[model samples]
Target: MLDKTKRDWWRSVVVYQIYPKSFQDTTGSGTGDLRGIIQRLDYLAQLGIDLIWLSPVFASPQVDNGYDISDYRAIDPMFGSMEDMRELIAQGKKRGIGIMMDLVLNHSSDQHPWFLQASSSRDNPYHDYYVWRDGMPDSPPNDMQAAFGGSAWTWVPQVGQYYFHQFVPQQPDLNWENPALRREIYDMILWWMEQGVEGFRLDVIDQIAKEPDRYITSNGPRLHEFLRELSRETFQKGCLVTVGEAWGADLQRAKQYSAPDGSELSMVFQFEQMMLDQQPGKEKWDLVPLPFVKMKASFARWQQGLHGCGWNSLFLDNHDLPRIVSRWGDDGAYRVQSAKLLATMLHGMQGTPYIYQGEELGMTNVRLPIQDYQDVEIQNFYQKRLGDGYPQEEIMNSIYAKGRDNARTPMQWDDSPNAGFTVGTPWLKVNPNYTAINAQSQLADPDSVFHYYRKLIALRKQYPVFVEGDFALLEAEHPRLFVYRRAWQGEELLVVCNFGGEATPWQLTQEWEDAQVLLSNYPQHPGDLRPWEAKIFYRKNGAAGES
Candidate 1:
């Protein structure tokens, strides 16, 4: 549980992450643009979001979907111009919403001026801006593997050296070891801050402070020093919300990155909870059922361990993940019920909640064949598996369950053609279920997933207990039930969710029998919970038979 006496505006904020390229397209370019996002400000405001975390639309070759930055100062032509971006900021502010940009500090595009000059000659001024090592043409300097699976080092023929890249070859890892490079990045951060941008979502920030010799990922020895330096240079200016995408961070590292001392960042997104269903010693493409005890223990530890020390980023789906309803809930026969249940579990937790675009409508993953997939990581994976003689169906099946493209599908705004996302053809296929699942269909239905999410967000804003309350986990071993309680001052909230596909007994103690319902997915429930049902109950101290 969090300390109710200590309050921060961001703790009660609801963030919505929008992938610009898939959000909407107003120019008939078959890709979403800034103008498209601006047109939807009211739509997002209606959903009760306080902040918008837009994915990168910076100048790039689109190798990793704008992540490989060619220029930090300009918007990609495909996404409209700088004027459009500024207009978005001004308009969002009018609605009481702030904007968070995706800041990719770990690397720059190989086509970037810095990388191009660095690759030109060993004595070039920008040569030290990126990581490079002397090695034989055919051999890498080390045995480190790239994130998408391969040697981390790529040969640069003109420079007669190998440069390190944690992702694809087009994305070259920057050398934070150099004082000049770090300053350049810091200056860029300040430049955006000066543009009325509220904050940044630091991309792969944990990998930025890698060991100079080993290329290891996650919390390096110099991580604290670097983060503190960033805070001193950028975050100290105001109440901007800076979050890091920390992939392999541990509990201790999580505490350090966003501690109350304000030396590092506002918070960080850790992948442990997202990786619960992944098999050990296997790649992310491999999937398994989530272990109840393991997940329960993890949730409890993080909640208690970081109680007053740091903050957590509460989420279930993002642009890089499969839809939550499809992955963690019953999406076949009970999609709506399960989606609402997942939302209840997410918003009831003690942390700032993040809603990925289209998640509010209970979007499910699209089962696309290999040919229909449109993601760089998925393309590379499928190519490798095909070359390795893996069956096509086996590869497609794995992709169907864990593909990043699942979350990248065009937004389903209405039942019209193309889901009303774009007047032109969409870059990727829209989910075929949009006809029945789009926002237009749900907006009119009071019991739709959209309304449920709206209610959850409104509750967080209205109740202090949902924001700064203490959390207590129950039924740690209950395979079907996710039971937890949040207490603040004299108010206690009991949140019970059924993650299974069948009815389960509600083991209420005597004190909890008279609990009044605050919210419920279904109209009513007697002694048992229906499949994927969720409910929250309110009780005050000494109010009833005391559970």
Candidate 2:
């Protein structure tokens, strides 16, 4: 069954996620702000996106690039004033785009008033706002490790207890077991909804309910109850979109998290495929070549497992990961083709496609020295690896390959001194190749990656097949080619992506030989698929969508 509202509101929509701090800086404060986003609404509209997902512009202490939210209702001064936020909402509506705020309900910055009061004394009413334990005063409460690194528990001598934080020491994990705390969070969410924000991307929402008496975290027994309650309270009230950042969610868990009854979220992001390149038992900075067969298998499982049951979110990179071109595609010789190939593969599937900022311009990863890096996790990784006796060059290379900062660099708007992101000094170094690879250069070129992406987005809007199609993997064993077919109402799209930098023979079966090309990175139909090539063919009843 579809959602009860039957809105079909988010199915074919495309979302462009903007890490506000690095998107554009107009305040001369060396940081992107609400005003910057307001100024670029036209630019975003030109991309043909239906929604803009801003990555946490709320008041923060910059401990984790705004993810460590200090205030739920106030806009950060560094980003803009509350008036600027209201203006952004009004202006964005005028441009025919909806705004989705990133809601970090999983944790709050330790500097937040509640946390401060909670940490002050045992008699404080807010003491239970966060998870606090008084066990083994000299030792941690548990053996759990923080997602960033080190012990998850921190000693708070002021309260004579240790507080649990799933991330850094400064971000205390909220205790959802407390009904009063839950009420406060829900109230904050309603306040944002009242301000005209249409949707929210729930940050680490699955981890909001931690299991009892366990060192591990997330997916506690009452997880579904909490999500269902939150949904009934906030999203179900209106046709608002909500997606959860579920780190280890599988197909079954995802189905429950985003049930067809609409009791929970619209969809949940699974990190299994994202972690396919990670070396097990090592830090995130540890990199390994992506296993192709595994990647194909994981994607196919999600596509098949969620079909007719739940929903899927299609994406390659986001603010917390390395650029897609550098990781899965060739960032050097075949950068443009590979970028287009990845886009074609993602958008042709049966899911809501997400385009991260600068991705439309085929932005590759930044190679910054250790001294130039700004991400706290990256710096922490470097120091940890160095203390563990790893070589400096190897650690630096690892950081270059997998550091989150690679995707956090300022967007390359033009070939200006600071890539046109800012008139003053940039908070982070712009990618050096921005001169050759930037939005301005691509926008002027007809055969640019940006144009190809625009075409893909338009096609999805034009055809319901892209939104409500049944998916099937064409060649499960094809090593270099990722082939998938989506069919709906006698309309089908055959998407073939050559993932490697080598030419290979690719021909359709006799039954599908009459397919006509709907999209392709290359100009001509190559009997042998070129390196890093992608082609999307549309087959109608007895003819093709295009000749």
Candidate 3:
């Protein structure tokens, strides 16, 4: 059993993200529900994961796939009742696994009662529950564009005003400036914690601190104060872990939020690494090559800046991202090899590692035709492409390269029909590669990517260096390879990943004389890397003790 008394349980833990809608459907309703997750507790425990972060199960309109919550206190009807959630938590705890629920506090569906009341009239008690502004004559407030690609202001005919929506118009941003609204959110959070949840994964957490006037900028004077208040009241309870999704967070801001003094969150997810593929002049999802040098430099910067000052929630693929095997590595022909390489690189990093559902099984992104795209974000971009006078071929190419729905498909559990996710039709089409990339196929093969992840998690738990270690970027100038070192106490770990699709020669530095091959994506020592292969080496003496 994993030790629960560790000072930083998150550092050594491997969190598996589960998009409840796509995980499994026990009721044959073509949608995964909480009872389905309850049935899979043993499977998750067998996978050796420390925690499971379930994407929002709260009441939502399914507009943003549960990210736009309507009722924070009740479970969505489509995802089973609150009793099912309680049972899932109870069963998960018995398997030595914790549960983290997604907390979408930044915004709520327009269907939410609070939003309905806020938009009902100008003098309603909940009128200030959400951001509402009067249009100055005929122009909207500022030039802040909605992230979903339109005007951030949506005119509410009922209120004769416009409300702010960072995402879809159906979802309205909550007014965090309202003290009563803040208390209500906190009360809901505490209520869930009392119901046996171990932690929360705050969605779009950085968006909550939007400047009252500036709106888009961070570092608002009141933002830190609000976070500090939340930390003191909601997060300092010791058992409840809080991880924030803070996009565009720099190292200094990360430190202030995750300081050991417990000012804000326990850790925050940084999006700098994820934004590498975004080209200079592109608005749509454009696929650019993942430059190893830039990736190395970004990792080094965060490592140097946040060492002992803050914590990072390290991840590659999530419901919002394209599969790492497809985007970062060569997933076409070198799928298995590249998957293992990406796993080694992410798991060996000094942070709390998150493994998306089916990531351990080397699940590649689903290839969807332009007509099959269902994600609102993708649809918005496609409409933008049309409105901007872009050719249909260019829009199709962009969708093929970077659609969020590629990662939102049903989890591949086995070679059976519907990827063993449901006996009924899946909500989204399953990837055809599920026949070869299922968990059952990988579980039987000891050398599969799934087993590599198992080893990586085991190593993180076994060696303190993998968790609380200080990180040092090795000065290897090879463009095809990314290398780094982690040292803590007297142990050291050397991580080398070949980002290219060709065999590359890796020269071990003299300082790694005592290194032992701990793990590798390909068979180490005897076998050479076949493009995007990775290896982890453990040295007897730490980097500090060497030389």
Assess each prediction's global lDDT (C-alpha) against the native. 0.88, 0.88, 0.83
lDDT of 3 by residue, 1-547 (tens): 7666554566668899999999989887889999888888887887789899999999998899988888999999999999888888889989988999999888899999998899889999899989888875457877788898888888877888888888889889998899999999888878887998888898888888675357664455677888888877786765566798888688889998788776788888888888887785665376677766888889888887888888877899898888888888777888888898888888888888899998888888776776677799988898887998988888877766678888888888898999889999888888999888898888899998888888898888888888877887775566887888887878888998888788876678788866888988776554455588788999766346542
- Stretches of candidate 3 above 4 Å error? 3-7, 136-138, 215-219, 526-530, 542-547
lDDT against true structure, model 2: 0.88
Q: Write the per-residue lDDT of candidate 1 for residues 19-40, one digit (tens) a residue.
A: 9999989988779999999999
- Please give, for residues 1-547, the per-residue lDDT of candidate 2 as tens digits: 1142444588768999999999999978788888889888988888898888999988889899998988999999988899998998899888778889999998999999999999999889999999988876668767888878898889988888989998999999999999999999889989888998878899998888885357548888788899999998888877887889999697899999777778899998888888988798766667888988889889889988888889999999899989999999999999999999999999998888899999999998988878898898988888988999999999988888888988989999999888999998889889999999998889899899999999999999887789888888877887898998888877888999999989989888776788888899999854899999899888787544432
Which residue pairs show backbone clashes in model 2? none
Compare candidates 1 and 2 on lDDT and give the better one. 1
Best by lDDT: 1
Worst 10 residues of 3 by lDDT: 211-220
lDDT of 3 at 162: 83
- Model 3 TM-score is 0.96
RMSD of 2: 2.7
* Model 1 poorest ten-residue lDDT run: 1-10
RMSD from true fold, candidate 1: 2.8
